[model samples]
Target: MARITAGIATSHIPALGAAIDLGKTGEDYWRPAFAGYEWTKQWIGQNPPDVVILVYNDHASAFDMNLIPTFALGCAENFQPADEGWGPRPVPVVEGHPDLAWHLAQSLILDEFDMTIINRMDVDHGLTVPLSLMFGQPQAWPCRVIPLAVNVVTYPPPSGNRCWALGEAIARAVAGFPDDLNVQVWGTGGMSHQLQGPRAGLINREWDNRFLDQLIGESDALRHIPHIEYLRETGSEGIEMVMWLIMRGALGRTTRCLHRHYHVPASNTAVGHIVLEPVS
Candidate 1:
């Protein structure tokens, strides 16, 4: 049966993707931030998974305020990059694992999680940026991807506890599959930075680092964090960190943080990334 071998959490800042696409990563302003991921790229190249279940939010690209699904799963054979205002970030089309995605759709629904099954949808920076951060600028992504879009853009998003439960369910579903494939669950977004309003340039490094520490060691208490606390401490957009619970919850009872990277001032956002795997 397929198994979730590891979990990854990261912040998907759009400017990071732009720096990569525009050949500006070598510049001094972006060099330090890019340097942090060099090890991860090498690590992933040596240990590639058959498929990656990427959890991220849509930035008014695929789903607008008119139609927002609390949890949307991509079941199509492939997904196109979305054009967010300027244009799509010259990235390869995302290939989907329909067999596994469909199975997850069925399993998750039966497990009482209402998921909007999507046959086709364009993916935005929220999804592609994370891929770029890990895999670099390849002609095509190394492995198939299943897009699990969560609604953190709008108010009343899923609670941390609920996201954690969904991750647990996904692990159970992957284990039930008969194929002997290695899978990775990735939660992308967060580390505290806010845009808009009076606190437009907020970056609470202390709180962000503390959150990361708790995530690595005290996730049970982390999941209970209220949304208002995120807004108050990390900024409004910092609420995206809640998605990390999904990745953490899927990693079974015990896990060790193999790698952790944290950087600041990347497009006014904190870049946080961590790699975790089951202890046994």
Candidate 2:
């Protein structure tokens, strides 16, 4: 049966994608940020998974105000990179694992999670930036991807507790699959950032670090964090951090953090990344 081998969490800042596409990674302004992921790139190369269940939020690129599903699972044969204004990022098309995706969709829906099944949709930076961050400019991504787009773009996104529970359901579903596949669940977005309003450039390093600490050592408390605190403390956009709980939950009750990286001022957002595996 398929088993989840690990969980990864990172901030999916779109500018990071542009930096790589435009060859600005070596530039001093972006060098420090990209440098943080150098070890991850090498580490993933050594410990590649058969499939990665990428958890990220759409940024008005795929689903707009007209429609928004709290949890959307991609069951497509493939997903084209979305054209976010300045054309699609010059990256390889995202290949999907349809059989596994459909299985997960059915399992999750039966598990009492209202999952919107997506047969076709273009994935935006929320999904691709993390791939670029980990795999670099490969002609094709090394592993098949299963895009799990969470709804964090709009108001009243699922709570951290709900997201955490969904992750647990996902792990249960994956465990029941008969394939001998190695899987990784990745949750993307947030360290602390607000894009608009009076507190536009808000970022709380201390709070972000505390959240990371809780994520690794005290996830029970982390999962119960309310949305208001995220807004008041981290920023309006900081709510994106709730997505990380899903990855944490899927890793099980306890996990060992193999690696962690945190950097600030990456296009006015905090870039946080961590790799974890369940404690055996």
Candidate 3:
């Protein structure tokens, strides 16, 4: 049976990509930000997976208000980095595992998830930054990526419980696949910081840390946190944290944390990362 080897959650801040593209990783402002990912890079180097099921939201770069599917899965053979008003980052195009992606689409639909099947889509910093942080600037990404874009940008995004349920369904599809492949589901974005409007630069270090602790130790309790609480305490953008529950649910009820890091002020966002392996 195919297996889920690991789960990862991190913030997909666009500035992190700029830091990489401009070679400012060691600069004063970005030094601490980049430091948070150092352990993740080394861990991935040692324990690589065959494919990554990346869960992130598009920032009006790929999907505008006109077309926002609550859940969209990329089945393309490759996805180019989107030019989000600025020129596209100098990142390698992401390769897709079509055969597995197709199987997943079929499985998810039958399982009542109703995911929109995307044949072509441009992935934004939300997808690529995480790749850059975890794998560095490789000419070609080290493994295949299956992009799972969730609609957190919209007002009525999927609820936290709903996202968690989808991840649980995905776990079944992944395990039932006949091929022997190592799969890692990554839920990227958030750790309590908001951008835009009067509340532009809000950072809740205490809330963010408490979230990380609960995410690892008391995830079941974390789910009870309503969307309004995330908006009220974490800022509107901080609501993206619900995506992490998808990764957690995919790992089953028990997991072992392999590596974890949290840092602040990455372009007005608090960055958080955690690596987990199912307690096999």
Q: Write the per-residue lDDT of candidate 2 for residues 97-153, one digit (tens) a residue.
A: 999999999999999999999999999999999999999999999999999988888
Backbone collision count in every prediction? 0, 0, 0
How much is 56 displaced in model 2, in angstroms? 0.5
Q: Which residue runs of candidate 3 sit more than 4 Å off their true CA positions?
A: none
CA RMSD of all predictions: 0.9, 0.8, 1.0
- Range of the 10 consecutive residues with the lowest summed lDDT in candidate 2: 211-220
- Per residue, candidate 1 scores C-alpha lDDT tens digits across 1-280 of 9999989999999999999999999999999888888888888898899999999999999998899999999999999999999988999999999999999999999999999999999999999999999998899999999999999989999999899899999999999999999999999999898899999989999988887777665347778899999999999999999889889888877778888888988988899988888766
* Residues 1-280 of candidate 3: C-alpha lDDT, one tens digit per residue: 7799999999999999999999999999889888978888998999998999999999898789799999999999999999998899999999999999999999999999989999999999999999999999999999999999999988898888888888889999998899999999999989787778999999999888887786664357766688999999999888898899889889888778888898888888898999988875
Error of 2 at 104 (Å): 0.5
**Candidate 3: residue pairs that collide:** none
- Per-residue lDDT of 64 in model 3: 92
Candidate 2 has an lDDT of 0.92
